[model samples]
Target: MKLYTWLSAPNPRRALIFVAEKAIDIDIEEASDPDNPGQLSKRYCEKYPHRRVPLLELDDGDWIAEAAAVCKYLEALYPDNPLFGRNAKEAALIEMWDRLAEWEGLMAVSEVFRNTHRLFVGRGLAGYDIQIPQISELAERGKLRLGRFFNKIDERLDQNEYLAGDIFSFADITALCAIDFSLSRKLIIPENCCNVKRWYQAVSERPSAIG
Candidate 1:
């Protein structure tokens, strides 16, 4: 199996970090567009129509596109570390928190970046080559939503060590990547969110986080 990734991207980083935490051995390919540098390569786009990063190409010629799905595939194959949780209840909790982190935090951060960054001026949305105009109002709204997300997570973190509970699961990984990605937009944990700051410090110190 092979994993195609763009290390600079936050979504791909989540998968990469999960792999590191699990200590899985797999062929890893760094993806890049020869013509556009940071964009997906033309040949890669042709091979994978969806054109998503952190893609997992199976030995059976099957492919998993989403980053979380990629991690799930890997976890099923290598279940030693058990990032998805060890039981049914744990799995549901992890999945629920992971979805919250992805939609509320990561998507919000991407919303601001896609609509405000010059690199995405004409391509505000991903997975398409067509011109999709950026809306400045969306960026402002994203910032507001992200702020609310941070506050909500802060309250949750106050009672537990990790996003889903006491265990450092995939939800923590997604939330970590989201918070780091938000830094590019000058968005950060509010000073009043002491619990979030504490959680960030602990998670960022992990060896997997460096990957």
Candidate 2:
């Protein structure tokens, strides 16, 4: 299998971390420059109409897009590590937290970064041909949303070691990527969120967190 990804991007980082945690062996192909969308190759764009990174091409020539979907495909292929969950209830809980991290954390940070950053002026939204103009108001709203997300994360970590529960799962990966991405965009985690800080430190020490 060939995994096409941008090493620095959060979504691709999630898939990369999943592969690292599972010790999966696959060919990795860097697809495009995240800062410059025009660098994406025509061949890759043909294979993935959405023109997004973290695309997986199976040996049999089947293509899979979307970071979470790629992770799910790998999980099904190699179940021993079992990052998703063991049972139905656990799976549901993990899924809930994972979605929260992606929507509340990752998406919020992305809204601020893409809208405000000069490099992404007309490309606020990913995987679309239409280029939306930057909205300062939306960037402010995104920052507010991300701040609340950090507080909520701290509260959850205060009760559980991991986002979903005691065990490390996919939710942790999503959160880690979100936190790191936010930090890169100059959104620092509040000092008052001690639980979140501790959790971040612990997760950062893991081998999978390394690029």
- Taking the candidates one at a time, how many backbone clashes does each contain? 0, 0
lDDT of 2 by residue, 1-211 (tens): 9999874889999999999999999999988745655456666777788888789999999899988889999999999979999999989999999999999999999999888887788888878767778888888999999999999999999999999998899999999999999999889999899999999999999999975
The count of residue-pair clashes in candidate 1 stands at: 0
Per-candidate Cα RMSD to the true structure, in Å, reads 1.0, 1.7
Q: What is the TM-score of each candidate against the true structure?
A: 0.97, 0.95
Where does candidate 2 have its weakest 10-residue lDDT segment? 33-42
Model 2: how far residue 35 lies from native, Å:
12
Candidate 1, superposed: residue stretches over 4 Å from native: none
Pairs in steric clash, model 1: none
| Cα-based lDDT at residue 2, candidate 2 | 95
Model 2 per-residue lDDT at 123: 80
Best by lDDT: 1
